[model samples]
Target: MASENQIVVLDGATARTGTGCMHGISWFVAKLGSTLAGLAADLDASLPSTLMTSIQAVADQHRATCDLLHPGTPSAVVALLRLNETVLEYLVLGDVTVIIDTADGLQVVADDRVDRTARAEREEADRYPFGSAEKQAALLRMKHAELAARNTPGGYWVAAADPTAARYAITGKIPLDTIRRVAVLTDGAARLVALFKLMDWPDVLELLDQHGPTELIRRVRAFEAADPSCMRWARNKRSDDATAVYAV
Candidate 1:
């Protein structure tokens, strides 16, 4: 007789104006035809939609004719996987991250977006005050981005664009046959994940195990309420978009 089968799930999220990354990974996932469309619409259409649409408009005017434009305003997201024994593969454009709880601690996997060019951009920012530098950088980045759009014309990522231009791209292929669980998250969730001395799915699962999803978000709200500074990470560090998910 067959044993109790395992479950696999693939979850993900996106923002309009990242480094044009969600589509690349989403394209791969959609091609794989796994559990769900990696970069689908947000559940909280009322709030996420408004922010995405508003931010995306500003990002649109930023592309250069040579670069790939973001399809819409960047939004955070989370994706999950529930499967028996198999392999897990994933990719990211912006900061959306993947954590694998292996025999070791939480293994954070990310893509190559912050390269030499990105480093140079950062160095330039250091030359000025954080606020003014951010504004100037935003403007310059958008200026070059606009040039890319002109060259590419209708070219853009995932049929959208975002203004902030924050992004990351990361993917992983793992042997799920031995793995116990996996979690996918955007920058927002990452903030909460860091709160723990040990950031692992078991912790998250434990929270979900005791309370429900509502409670998890509620905890986050309460946590945010207490520190409030923590939310700043969601705004400044992981600012663009956020999402998180887990599957065992």
Candidate 2:
């Protein structure tokens, strides 16, 4: 979602088989994204404050029909950039990446607490072959561990039923004059560097400069197709929802 002054990208979580929400992940992300964008447009609030209000608003819409406290309930990682006259205000929560091409160099803002949590279980899951029953069992254990850590102190935070998670988002301002370009990417699109080791951040920015955002995502899909079994680049899913927004 983008407008004259703001850009918003949301990566909705993959719905679990038994998510306690009455709505799907798509519904959650669509509502949350629109609400956040609307609030940001109408209110003179900070990025995090607008996000908090949006989450609370969405929760109010579904609270009576769904189990809001369930860990598996609908959630999303957020990447937001608001352009001001002299500065750019940005917010990142969960794994979404916001890359800034500035006069000094490239700056990346992302939250990695999810990777820091459930270490043992994730390692165990990695030990088993992908698509095997053993791997599935290990992944289940990892999921449970992740659920236990979600939104807790020292754990990762995402945009979910808890409005307070907005407080944990990475937020800051960068001088607008120093920025040459900006790219906001969901984790799926970032897998090119973060997971596949295909390129560095500079390389990614260069790619975006030369080819554009669609080509970046196309390359990611090509790589995933080449390694369909996850043998070369191990991952939880073969293909994820990839999205990218580039601004100059």
Candidate 3:
């Protein structure tokens, strides 16, 4: 979601078997994203505060019917950019990548605490064949480990029922004049550079410059199609939800 002064990108977490919420991930993200956008438009509050309020608002809506304390409750990674006359402010929560093309160079911000946690389990899962029962078991272990660490002080945080998680988001402001362009990508769309190593960040911005965001996502899909069995990529999912937004 984008407005003249603000851009909000949310990648909803895939729903687990029991998310504890009556609504789906799509509904969670939509509600959170729209609420964030509306609050951001006011511009009086900081991005983190706005996000916190938005999260609480969403939680309130579902608190009556849902088990908000469930570990697998719906959540999302967020990337938000707000532009004004003097500065461009950004907030990144979870794995969403926000790349800024500035006069100095490209600046990339991503929260990788999730990757750092459950390392042994994830590595074990990666060692087995994609479709084998061994892989499934390893993957389950990884998920359990991740759940144990989720939203704790030493663990990773995401936008879920807890509004305080917004305070952990990476945030900064840059002089608006120094920025040339900006690209926000969900981890899926960023697989080309992050997971596949097909290109560098500069290459990614260059590709966005020449071919546009669609082309970047197309390349990711092409790579996923080539490695359908995950033999080369060794990913949990053969394909993920890919989303990219470019602003200049």
Candidate 4:
């Protein structure tokens, strides 16, 4: 949901194994969004400084609702942004991304450390057919490596049940007047540019300016529909859940 001049995008992680209640991720995201909104009202504290407290509040809510600890339950990546008259503040956790429309051009901010760790396995999986046993084995290997790297030093971080992950978030502030607009996107919606290379960031900005966020998602889904087996894309899911928020 878009708040005031803020854009928040949250995507629930695909369950690794059994189908349990992934409600925790949504709950965490909602609480986190609210916390950040509340914190944004006070410009006295920097975004990075307030991050830990915001994360802890969400973690506490998660524990109270799901009764699960870090690395135990499902998690989600988050992309949050606030644009005021003076400054544009942004925070990115996990693989979600923020695209800012700057006076010079479009600037993209994304956390891809998770992708760096799984490249080899992803390539190996792509070597075999989609449903082949070899492909499955390779994918499994990739998933294991990714899991091991999560929330650790030298590894990627996400907004899991872990409060400490707040420290891993990428955050900063830019001159508000320099930014024309901003888009907060989950990995699912960002596949068009990141995974598929269907368009560059500038092209994405053009799309957003013309048709809006829904058009961008529709374009990605259309591409996926044409390549249902992911034959051309070589992805984990044929179609992933996607979400985006645009603030102008």
Using lDDT as the measure, the top candidate is 3
Q: Give the TM-score of candidate 2.
A: 0.96
Model 3 pairs in collision: none
Q: Candidates 1 and 3: which is better by TM-score?
A: 3
Global CA lDDT computed for model 2: 0.89
Look at candidate 3 and tell me the lDDT of residue 223: 96
| Segments of candidate 4 deviating more than 4 angstroms | 18-23, 62-72, 128-137
Better of 1 and 2 by lDDT: 2
Residues 1-248, candidate 1: write the lDDT tens digits.
Answer: 01133212222233223444433445433332221232222322222233234334433433432133343322222222223137554434334456677655566664323222334443444344324546456536543443343213242222134422212223345676556655565445555565432345567656654664455555555555654432333222213223445555
Candidate 2 deviant stretches above 4 angstroms: none
Candidate 3 residue runs with Cα over 4 Å from true position:
none
TM-score of candidate 1 relative to the true fold: 0.43
Question: Order of all candidates by lDDT, from best down to worst?
Answer: 3, 2, 4, 1
The Cα error of candidate 3 at residue 239, in Å, is 0.5
lDDT (Cα, tens digit) per residue for candidate 2, span 1-248: 99999999999876534678888899999999999999988536899999999999999999999999887988899988998778899999999899999999899998888999999998888776677888788888888888788888989999999999999999999999999999988999999999998798889888998999999999999999998777688777788999989889
lDDT by residue (tens digit), candidate 4, 98-151: 888889877889988888887788788777766677877887887777777888
Distance from true position, residue 121, model 1, in Å? 9.4
